[model samples]
Target: MVGVSSARDRISLRGIRVTAHHGVFDFEREQGQEFVIDVEARLDLAPAASGDELAATVHYGELAQEVADAVRNDPVDLIETVAERIAAVVLAHEAVEETTVTVHKPQAPIAVPFDDVAVTIVRGRA
Candidate 1:
């Protein structure tokens, strides 16, 4: 098991929209659709806050772009995989100790009407 950190500080980026080709069906892969991603990263903020330095903190705007890029990359069959990819990206930041990622598929291929479908994952450093 990985040792858990008790960090309370976090930076959350929500509702990041991206159009990507990812699904089980042929049409889904060929036509593509939109996906919404939410990411929450946990870290120690005291260094950045006390020093008032951008370098000490994770650049969220850059993070968002990286998340979007991950989503738009290689197509996968499950939103779970996408969520995992997003988590990996967030954890790549040296300051991020833990991350929770949510990948939302609003237009999922369900017979009945639904608002959305999503997969959420929480990851922490070892």
Candidate 2:
């Protein structure tokens, strides 16, 4: 005989805005832009559920702080690269089984007015 049990795998955060100089053109970099970051993660919950400890699971607050830290410190030319970097950082955590990062850039230097430009990527432990 065998027994089946449920497990949880979800972590998410949203609306993290960071104003930074990130772009290809000199003017765009000088002027800066509004970046909105959204992050989601998935991991096994057995350790956390059993011990009620943070060390056993992915800490969403810490992940958000890391995202803010990366944007504030690094100067990248593209949101795609930003998303990739964020995903990499999240996946680096041993407890994180998978992660997704979305970086939104509004008020770009383009002549046209649009909602926003963004990139979303998903990464998993390999």
Candidate 3:
């Protein structure tokens, strides 16, 4: 097996778009909107690299589906909660040592004119 020295060596998935009901307001919840998600998983890659096998490392395609499912299937009131949930799901993979999840709410119910609203969280093994 190969070892990973730093979290910098990771598998990253970005701009996963999903329509879901998540917000603090009833209107926002009732009228689901688009959400963007980004995920980075840190794990050992030596085994996969040495063996030249897909099983040795994280399967990012499947991981992306899992993240999208988490966003679509679960409903929450805050983007923070969404980010946490995504992190938890990514961390659940046995190979993952640490993960960073970012949930973007472009259509947030803020009165001010802003480009975007997002929450990012990082979680790692204990």
Q: Each model's number of backbone clashes?
A: 0, 0, 0
Question: What 10-residue stretch in candidate 3 is worst by lDDT?
Answer: 1-10
* Candidate 1 wrongly placed segments (more than 4 Å): 1-6
At residue 93, candidate 1 shows an lDDT of: 99
Compared with the true structure, what per-residue lDDT tens digits does model 2 show for residues 45-81?
Answer: 7768778998888777888888887776678898888
Q: Kindly list the per-residue Cα lDDT of model 3 for residues 42-86, writing each as its tens digit.
A: 987777788899998889999999899999986889989989889
* Each prediction's TM-score versus the true structure: 0.94, 0.86, 0.93
Best by lDDT: 1
The worst-scoring run of ten residues by lDDT in candidate 2 lies at 1-10
RMSD in angstroms, candidate 3? Answer: 1.9
Higher-ranked by lDDT: 1 or 3: 1
